[model samples]
Target: MILAKKKQRDFHQLSTPWNVVFNLFAGIFAFLCVFPFLFVVIISLTDEGTLAREGYRLIPSEWSFEAYKYVFQTGDTLLRSYGVTIFVTVVGTIISLLFIAFYSYAISRKSFKYRNFFSFFAFFTMLFNGGLVPTYIVVTQLLGLKDTIWSLILPLAVNAFYIMILRTFYSTSVPDAIIESGKIDGAGEFGTFIRLVLPLSLPGLATIALFSTLGYWNDWFNALLYIDNPNLVPLQSMLMRIETNLQFILQNSQNSSLGLEALRNMPQDTSRMAMVVLATGPIIFAYPFFQRYFIQGLTVGAVKE
Candidate 1:
């Protein structure tokens, strides 16, 4: 009875300090992550004149939603860009996940004759690539993907690192006994993969899917390089244009009948903040939904058996 009480006391003593330290670090990191977003939100809602008078602050001196109102005034441009981003993210993630999953599965199979050779081929691309100009020419001139949504989706559809990670996961986690059992049950190679392998690899798939979706969603480079159509511009690129180019903002502001003078007087800085918040809204919302899956997937795939 005395020993048990001592053990219990020691456990409580150890846990108390650890819990305090953990909570302290977690709170600090959480504040660091959330502070910038809070500042952005506060600035976005601040009156333009107030922002011009005083730079950004955690709390706005005068609150107003004019920037958001101005953004939604036309609404079509923003809405269209959002639609394009969504379409590309969905389509690109699906294509990338399918290709990576199939290729990884093939490479993970020990009996596959050319697995090593194919793995080397895929891995080699990561080390060296045909440089930017040639790649651009091939994608734009040869493939004729310029100015289309395909320009955004096709070029970045396959990522080498993701494939490697998935391959490692399949090789480490999946048991050879299961495959042999499936074969004994009269399942063909394709059927075994479809029924047994893919189900077990969901964590790896979820991890890669999140990576692909983020890549597709945040990508402005492909659009900047190959896409010339204003209608096909993704939200990030549109936000970039609106924020960096005063003339474009002025032109957009003109459509509201506030005139150049009033727009100049308005909180240009606050509007930039508002535009950033608007552009990132979808990602902010979608991230939490996939976050649990992402964490689980990465943990499983990263562990070697």
Candidate 2:
């Protein structure tokens, strides 16, 4: 009865006029946030002639699919790069989440014999690193991961910062009594972690998963350094190469009036927007699936005695 009364009291605290003002401002804020991407989509659909003649517009007088058409022209290469990127993102995010969870969970436990030592071990790496040349030699020479997908995955798989975040989250958000109870129920370390701890830690795990997913999706430098095979090139690397080649073509074009007009007709600006849409659309859609867990993870053990 008190809980229901508290809920009712809170609901009435807003007042109708205040609620209207809050919602009005929130709607405007949301529109402002979303308008840039909408503008990009409109630009991608605008005809090259219209774009060149007029500046960017919310509604173009003419529309064309030339940008998308050009992107799709390399159908086989596009599909292959897309497959490689998806595979890398999925596999990398899973591996990253598992490693982070285990390492963080291990270090967060006060009962662990080497908790402080392992905690310092991860922290020490955050302060210093063997420079790129030496690190490169290790991966390429010692590990023989060069020109392989493992090179991409292994390079970025473990982040010290992510381990720290998960460790803090686990410490503050998981109560000791619960683990004792699980132990009392005859659960082992792995069993208690899987059955009790993981269920309560979804929000923290979800946050890390989203970060890892974005890191893998947008990575091109790793592909540039480690992947030499054409077939192993991921989407971002392929897109970078496409943009570079396009710029080269534009630079070497004829320098005359007709040539300038031809340049105007080419899908430079529009193609960029098309690429932006293609690259970002999937990740944008993915954010909503993880949104609920990100903040709610903070509240996990708040009510515990």
Backbone collision count in every prediction? 1, 0
lDDT of 1 at 305: 42
What's the CA error at residue 14 for candidate 1, in Å?
Answer: 6.4
lDDT for predicted candidate 1 compared with the true structure? 0.85
Q: Model 2 over residues 175-280: C-alpha lDDT tens digits?
A: 9999999999999999999999999889999999999999999999989888999999999999888889779768866667766765766799999999998888
Model 1 stretches astray by more than 4 angstroms:
1-21, 247-263, 298-305
lDDT at 57, model 2: 94
Task: Give the poorly placed runs of model 2, Cα more than 4 Å off.
Answer: 1-12, 255-265, 298-305
* Candidate 1: residue pairs that collide: 48-267
Predictions: Cα RMSD each: 4.4, 2.7
